[model samples]
Target: MHLLRLRTDVAELLLSTQGAAVLGWSLDTDTGRFPLLRPARHDGNGAPDETAAFPLVPYGNRVGGNTFSFAGRDYQLVPNAGDRYRLHGDGWLSDWTVEAATDNSATVALSHTADESAPWDYLARQLVTLDGYRLTLTLSVENTGRDTLPFGLGWHPYFPLTSRTRLTAPASSVWLEGADHLPTEEVPLPANLDFRKKAPVPARWINNGFEDWNGCARIDWPERGLTLTIDTDPIFSRYVVYRPDTARDPAFAGDWFCFEPMTHTVDGFHMPGMGGLTPLRPGERLEGHIRLEALALQTGYQRATGKDYPGP
Candidate 1:
């Protein structure tokens, strides 16, 4: 696995060619280096899931039953990574080729051919860049298959979750998930799940998709005196928020949670309107960007939130 390091005076990033995952991202602050995303538990060399974030190409999330009918044709996907459904598409499991790299930016590319396991032929690319206190990840995919197929893109990022961590992202509705962790129905956001205002991450298990998002979110760490703002391209109108339970996931700890910016809803393949998956003919492409800005609370936190700084 080839690992690339992109560093600047204000920020630093580590990425692995394996799955094109971001191993870590942190900001240099006067107090110390503050982690923008969850730090890899082990060395920078590890599975993509252990990294700070990874790209979701072709599509993101699951398609029920590992089967779907598109354009009057049926397609089947084999379960990957030991999951019941073909989870998160192939980008995360396939090795990516580093096309270029610089001190603060890098581009990774991937090519996949049609097969029984995944019947979509496509070419994908991800560009990661860090400027000052901002980091942007742009993912693009082109349908290289003979038949027109639905395509989507997204990013799964693990962020540091503290006891006082608060999230503020506005969404119109939420999808209720079934036992299989797939969307069962769309319903109004519940009081506990409503993040229209800054609120703590729920203590209970949460694995659901939020729709009609404004393409923006914020996470504040009062204790650390840090705040992160997440902004996405307009194409990303949906997102998923997940927190695993210890009972189901042996690796579970309260230290981290995922905020996924997706172009389509989970299980978009089977949704009535195909959720939001865009149909792409040969040579057609779909793409979007997710941008994050890390800031020290001392400068503008009190002014923006109208709350006094809770210093370190």
Candidate 2:
């Protein structure tokens, strides 16, 4: 496994070419050591799901029926994982090549060719950079096939979940999940599901998609004495928050959760307007960036110092 490391005085990040995934990321602050994302189970040797985070290229989430019709042509996608539907495209399952690298930044690229199994051809690139206590990831994809297709982008980042972990991301509505783990309906945010304010992630199976996000979110780990703020490009207006338990994932131990920033809704291929998936012609491209800043919560006399307060 080829792994790249980016580090600063206060933070460090590990990336692997296997899936262009973040193996692990953490911070060393005056308060303590904080694992921003869940530590990888076996470093770069593990699968993307076992890593801290991975890219969602071409599209994100599952596409219902694994088929869609665009511009009078129909396309079918094969399930890339054990899931019933094609999930997160193929970026997380394919190996990427290193395009560039430095002490604090690295870029990885992947090229996919259309086939009967999955007919979406594209070239994807991800740039991971670390500066001080902040990390930024910029992902871009270019349609390289003959037919025009709807394309999307996103990131699947897992954060350590603790008893005191809280999330705050105001969204207009949420898509309820069906038994098949696919979205079933759009409804007003429920009190238990609402996070307009800082709230604990409900301890149940949650795989809903949030809509009309303001491109910002926050995760507070009071137990770790640190907080992480997520800022994304306007192109990514939707997000999915997932919380799995032992019932859904036997290997799960309630240690982590996912707050995925996506450019389109899950199963957008079947929704009107393609759910947010942009129709791209050959040579057309789509891009987005996500920034994560880590700050140490102030103690007794520790005055606020760092980026201006990112309001909720």
Candidate 3:
């Protein structure tokens, strides 16, 4: 496991080449240690289920039945997880080539060719830089194929869920999960699930996608005195929040939850809005950036400090 470490006076980030995943991010503040993102689990290939967070390229989430129609042609994708749905692109599963690195920054790249395993050919890059207390990630994907293809980019970060963990990301609405754990319908934000006013993640198991995201979210761990403000570029207009129910899966016993910043909704390819899929001409590139800033919330300052990070 080759680990790349980036540190500054008040913050540190560890990135592993395995899946271009974030091993861990924390603050070395005067108050104490504050974990910003969930720690990585292993050093193998980037395993989205194990790593703290990984990049989703080409597309994110499912495609409903592993098939879709694009530009009048029908396409079929290989189901990765149990052959049910195609997963967060192949970039996370393949090792990335280190293009450049420094004391506080690293750039990794991955090249993929159209094959039976995947339908598109592309070159993807992830550039991570540490500046003081902020960790910025610039992610991009380029269509290297001969024909036009639809693509999207995103980040799958597992956030540590605490009893007092609260979330705030104003979205236009949300998608209700269907029996397959994919989205079914888009509806108004429910009172309890709506974070327009900021609210704790409900104890109940919930796996859903929010659309027209405001390009930012805040996660606060009161017990740990850690607060992470996640802001992203405009390319990403969707976000997914998932908290598994312990009874459904033994793996749900952990203290982590997912607050994925996505460029499109889950199964967006088949949805009416096409889930924000962008048609990319050959050689065209899609890029976006995300910033995760950690702070130690003081006693009297219980408020979340994430302002509306504007999008394009």
Between prediction 1 and prediction 2, which has the larger TM-score? 2
- Candidate 2 residue 143 C-alpha distance from true site, Å: 0.6
Better model by lDDT: candidate 1 vs candidate 3: 1
Any runs in candidate 2 off by more than 4 Å, and if so which? 298-312
What value does the lDDT take at residue 16 in candidate 3? 82
Report residue 165 deviation for candidate 2 (angstroms): 0.7
Q: Give per-residue lDDT, candidate 3, residue 272.
A: 69
* TM-score of predicted structure 2: 0.95
Candidate 1 residue-wise lDDT at 291: 87
The weakest ten consecutive residues by lDDT in model 2 span 299-308
Name the TM-score of candidate 1: 0.94
Per-residue lDDT tens digits for candidate 3, residues 134-181, read: 789999999999888889998888888888889999898999999888
Comparing 2 and 3 on lDDT, the stronger one: 2
TM-score of each: 0.94, 0.95, 0.91
Which portions of model 3 miss their true places by more than 4 Å? 42-46, 297-312
Candidate scoring better on TM-score of 2 and 3: 2
